[model samples]
Target: MSKPSGKSMDEIVALCRRRGFIFQSSEIYGGINGFWDYGPLGTELKRNLKNAWWEDVVLREMVGPDGKTIEMVGLDSTIIMHPKVWEASGHVAGFNDPMVGCKTEGCKRLFRADKVFMVDLGLDPSGKHVDVGVEADSKAKAEELAIGIAKRFKIRHDANPNPIAFSVLEEFAEIPTDMQRFPCPNCQHRTLTPPRPFNLMFESHSGPIQSDDNKVYLRPETAQGIFVNFLNVVNTTRVGVPFGIAQQGKAFRNEVTPRNFTFRSREFEQMEIEFFIHPSTAKEWYAFWRDNRFAWWQSVGLTSANLQLREHEKDELAHYAKEGAGTSDIEYRFPFTAPGFGELEGVAHRSDYDLRQHAEHSGLRDKMKYFDQERNEKYFPHVIEPSAGADRGTLALICEAYTPDPSRPSGVYMKFHPRMAPVKAAVFPLVNKEGMPEVAEKLYRELRKKWVVDYDPKQSIGKRYARMDEAGTPYCLTIDGQTLKDNTVTVRYRDTLQQERIGIDRVGEFLGQKIGSAQV
Candidate 1:
């Protein structure tokens, strides 16, 4: 029989749950939206991804255009910094998503209007698709498009006996504000409230006071925490200018609509690096970091064919980078949207804006610069930040690795890179008896000392192999009747399904060589 190809997002989600990779946050009591918990396999897959990013991208040394190599240091900053941190970073005023809700009595669902409209109009909402080139002009044309789309479209309404025709949807495309202006997407009634700035930061009261006196917000991005600690890292580590501070941690945003599984979530983790460089050197550094970041994503098993380098238009640039810096996004070909792609990471050139803002707001304005020891002059360092979401990265890896199970056309498997597989190796016995179980168990125990190995003596060898493939186990070692006569086991490869005989004593070394390392 012929093998299958790729899988759908819905299929991936189902497989994740079935294989103990991910689960909804509180299944018993009606689970929360925009939040999910990583199960055992999901956790390993995520951990390996984060470690790979850190090892290959963040912590590595890089040479600048001037041929000077710079080293990067890692930081684990607080999830909640000083309340003024938000004000300094512009998160308080700028970190907002436009939200519109249905005015229907019971189906009052809120959604990110731009995203929904793109989907409704058969447009892909990725940074590389709906948000680039012509998308640069979309800010001025969204209302026009919504108007055009509505002229011929009719949708059901809560009050009207029939669907509303040519309903007004201006509110959905209008600029961000605190007004209700569009029709409810659910009920065709012109019941959508005005577009409002929904600040995404999760807020809380610090200390004993529960008032504005101690108001603070959970860190919405990991970069700010790294920005504020520039002085500490430079001083303690003896790091010089043009260096970077990397961080990976949890961030919070009360998303209006957190659809697409873990791709967008209210509580998520971020892996970010704020690379400091001279203002005159920002362009070179930007290109360098951008290319390196792009390559790293591909190295993590995302196919190059499906990745895109989406440069930000002048209009798409963030407020801090618009004046003097460049910005772009690395988008991936996801399966959910029509275009099958979306933004996975953002690479931006943020001039001294961040450090400048932090200094002025935190009473450290003069303290955020670096001294050129050779020139004996001090200047505020511009930054080229490559920021990525951990959840999205994990999802992208899952998407890239997922394939249909060949044995069962309807079933699926993960063709994860050897280094990226959750369980490194799976051990199985051809049959439950015939001393096969003892050999498989012995090999499994020995391999577990060096790798995350799975042991199974139940079911037929074919079924066990199918389960291992689904879980993305790169190698499957089967101890069969032949193993009783000789100390060799049949090692089946997950990606190719090729089998070869290897001595039981050499299984560890065999896998270590195939996977590049023991994985321990």
Candidate 2:
């Protein structure tokens, strides 16, 4: 079954901007494409998400398929590394996307070749039905093509025999040599250039002199850092084979088209695990990680039908996983891709390719082998990697939490999981007098030491509850008139809008029960 987010991308983006969740980078200067800035709320939400992942994967005690405890360690690698690192990882030579450019005068624009589709506009001229094709890279662009054609032909919007009736002709794997037949999406003219390779890595100079010798590139992934340091980890730690190295850090990629908010940004964060295991047990470990990672996402509040697990096809395998058991993806059905899913995470069986490549390139082939004491043999251990995008996962959580209702003043409330909510609880005074403020402030001070709690006594009780609901605060403790007499407070629940009076001393225990401990 497929679950569609009743919300639209426009609504989600608007909420992000209005509620201080996210903002476009350099927005005052018309903003830069493929970049974004997270606001205070967004930063807290992302930090909580990353912390949850780290605690679950690295700090928590995990069991392997053999019923033994798994060993996992953490690493923080630099964003800029030795230039030779990219050479060994195949990013320097093979990380290229097929690109095509529109040559229309004063309107040049580039697009990924495979993403450009040719659509038949079905324009009839002189009683003969003629197929007029236009190029577009998205559904919005296709709608623009239809409107442009309607205006050019002086056809009314309500006319029968619509001139804009059309369907996709084909997607261009590569623009043909005779590219004049295809029209430009912007200029609506036959001016698209042939396809060519465009590298996605960002380049820079490492020294004072700007020359080829001092040139460097940003690390495109965090996995290579783990692979290059595998020997150091094995030597310094007590972990044997069947161990894993986990990392969470920033990664860079100059995406040609960074659309769908932060989904395809040029800069992002990744939570990746590279598990080293015996070559003979690669299949079992691969299946275990695939299922384990899927369940982890569900445990963190992705319990809707929008989440799914899909196995990769033969052609979909990455360069390193071709000789292994294959790759599986945990995908989410976002608002933009409703009824169709987008990749949230991937669990791949990367057969000793990384270690082998790094060892061969660094001339440490003999030292890179792992000695199995049980089998009394030395060999390169196979890898099972579970890579997840921090930014993408945070966005999915936000998309899943957005709930609209006509009965409330704010019309919508964020239904974030108690463990994942930015503000765990809010304390409000029914009115700003009669010792209620003192009581609420004391409670706020105490709770803030344990979890993120808000204190808002400047507004009406209903308004305060509305604000906290929008912020996804699970519980709200209100010090009402009865608090001073009986020493009890009203606890308002965000999801059901139900309230019940409870002892003032039990507030801490109440929050602890609803949400988890403050450690994560």
Candidate 3:
């Protein structure tokens, strides 16, 4: 099928709010800066996405690289851990971002140094484009600045009248210290300060006494929790090397700027797997996961055109992954990063760095090693980590499923996969009279027992279908006058709009066949 032209972020955000998908946090109190709350539909959609991941990664058995069944296990870890855990994991000392603050009198906005870009404003006295720099936090903001400058100066170019093209001159960090004074993004003055290292972790006191002794931090990633419990899992379960520990939980990062809706939220959830393997098999396992994860996203409905798997370069490798095979990222072309792409998930080969660190810091060096009875040797197992952002995946799904069609009653409909749709099927009565409501209500109650179904007795049949379309409901079953005699109802497919007559008693089987095992 041909892909539809991309939709703007504004359109997607408006649909989300109108359909009760997502909402700003604490809107009554003017809202928080870097947080969001998922509404009923959004909550169900997210839950379905996470459940699908858990089922596919942990519960289902798959063939390994050696053509044998691989073992997988699940874990649920706490959000807060011992402070030393962070120290061992290198987060306490080095989990920082280069931050710069605007020194303008009325605007003291903070920004990540690398995120700040310098763009050409094309404002020159001689009617020629100059290289004078204007700073902005993102490419979108940079384009906005270009338009604002053009309007302010009333400069029009005959060759290209639509605001001369602008490109990022350089990053804030690349500028020399002597010439670091750039215009602030907010106030548009040369009052920005030099970049400094700022920790991204959120800190709090564990007890009533607010002191350094009881200082604690919210976890910044879910991978560490799996690492800390490596030995416990090995000892408790009958699994050996070449197994994985999967986890899904909340993680917090105090981002300097969270502008891309839920894409860069300060608080979010993650689906991570720390797959342990023999040192000799690190390369093979890394390749397996990189290919496997890329396919998994496509199976869940992300199109191949918008999804890509990119291998990291030497300079881009993380500290722990430097000695390993390498790391690969699965990127999605979000509306904000349309021409380009943003990171959706990363598959990295961590060469026993986490296990070694936790072992040394916790004074359990021997306990952290895995015993290989076949080889009669014990050592720290190498890990292949597949870490994905749950919120980012949810956002990607919403963006991909949005389809605009003027032929439909609703201008736009969410073309979600049957397994991923928030509402599996919606039930409606053809009319209010002739006992159609009774039949529709009974069908709705029966389907709701096993799936998330909707029943609407009000409004016209066309309007009900439109509402379901916006909600991303895959199938709509309507009871007409013929149903009272024939015991059959019309099942209207959401995507094709084709209808088929099926017995009312066989509705559950029809949904089960269409939705697969996603049903309750």
Candidate 4:
């Protein structure tokens, strides 16, 4: 309302902080970069999203096309594991970003050269920078010319005669030596050294004194924890292949540059499910999850025109992935892309990569064996992972639901689906007098049994209605003099702003149908 002060992304972040949805981590000490803490409303909203995910992929897998349903079990995994786990997973060796630090005056900014170049030129780093043209054209010449300009002007790692752990992009391009930096790229005041790799994992000691054997790492992804414990669940629960292990947990990533608010964070929560299927069935399930995740966004009321599926290029797959896909592929159809089309979720086909790595390093990997006596098949199960960021989804939901009332320019409210709204309904007393307060209190207490309801008696009935509307409470109930005599109350709808008098006893039933029927 009031045209909302900052830009969309800025407004969302400000609203979140003001409403106690989230806060910067360690704010008292100037805050830690790339980490955040969820306050009251933020916690509730996050839990709502997690609850929604659990209800679908975990508690109920939903009905299949054949009209049959599947029940899936859930897993709560550890936040840290053995250090060797990272080594075998290829994280210790390959989990890195090519960084070049600048000592330009007081500006000691370390950056991903690849990203900064595109950012400076106002281009999508994920697009043409990595693509070669379809055929011989001026595009190739332009790209080559652009590369030459970038190497000389752009801040990058210095040149070297010996091999560096990770080579700079221009080095492999056979650019002229004059373009390479012999001294620090930022200052050009000191002789430069070759670029080196930096491990991204956060390490910790098991006991008092740190030692080699006691070394452990904070998990970079939730999927690995599930994969490491797959055998335990399979053997103990006696669940065969084709089952999944769903987990919601915290993960840490030491990013080189964490910008665009919480879009890229050092610490965040993730909702991941490793659906195990036969290797032959992995592709089929991958497609199935791609659609399922897409539908999930829609169910939360996201416009389909705002989302699309994109298959990864052959060179883009990770060492463990055979087939990988992203959820936000199409360009911005929806207004909020301040940081540009943020990835809401992804599904990747990881073919026994995790289990095989753990088995090779830890000597504990057992190939998942499934027997179909009639079909006579047994093999290690391939996995399709539907990984999503809880924060990203939470933020996207806010953006999607945020609406400015055209009729009432000063009024703003979230049009959240009932299942996702933090407060489903608000109960108010028409006046804080006579027996109205007591009657409204009774209704509020009763309604809380079935929904998340708030009681507001500090302001006028009109003021209370506006407050609830701003909080995205879909339904509001007010007890008036009529309620004391006839046991009837006014039920106000948030979206339509229509009020209907209903028997007090039937308010619970009436609201339940409306709230429950709303999509997630």
The whole-model C-alpha lDDT of candidate 3 against the native structure comes to 0.85
Residue by residue across 169-260, what tens digits does model 1's lDDT show?
Answer: 24234443423333354554546666556878899988886998988899988899998889999889977877888899999988768998
User: In candidate 4, which residue ranges exceed 4 Å CA deviation?
Assistant: 1-7, 64-68, 96-98, 101-193, 323-339, 365-375, 517-520
Which 10-residue window of candidate 1 scores lowest in summed lDDT? 127-136
Cα deviation at 63, candidate 3, in Å, is 1.2
The per-candidate count of clashes, in order, stands at 7, 0, 0, 1
lDDT of 4 at 264: 78
lDDT of 4 at 256: 70
Best by lDDT: 3
- Clash pairs, candidate 3, are none
Which stretches of model 2 miss by more than 4 angstroms? 1-3, 96-197, 517-520
* Overall local distance difference test of candidate 1: 0.76
How far is 279's C-alpha from truth in model 3 (Å)?
1.0
lDDT tens digits by residue: candidate 2, 336-425: 888898899999999999899989999998789999898899999999999999999999998999998879998989898898889999
Least well predicted 10-residue stretch by lDDT in candidate 4:
129-138
Give the per-residue lDDT digits (tens) of candidate 3, residues 1-520. 1223467788899999999899999989999988999999999999989999999898877888979788999999999999999999999876666667887777888776656654454545657653323455556666556655545545442344333223223444555463344655555566677777788898888999999999999999999999999989998999888899999999999886888899999999999999999999999999999999988888888865889999999989999999998899999988888778889999999999999999999999887899999778899999999999999999999999998889999999999989889999999999987899999999999999999999999989999999999999999999999999999999999999899999999999999998884321
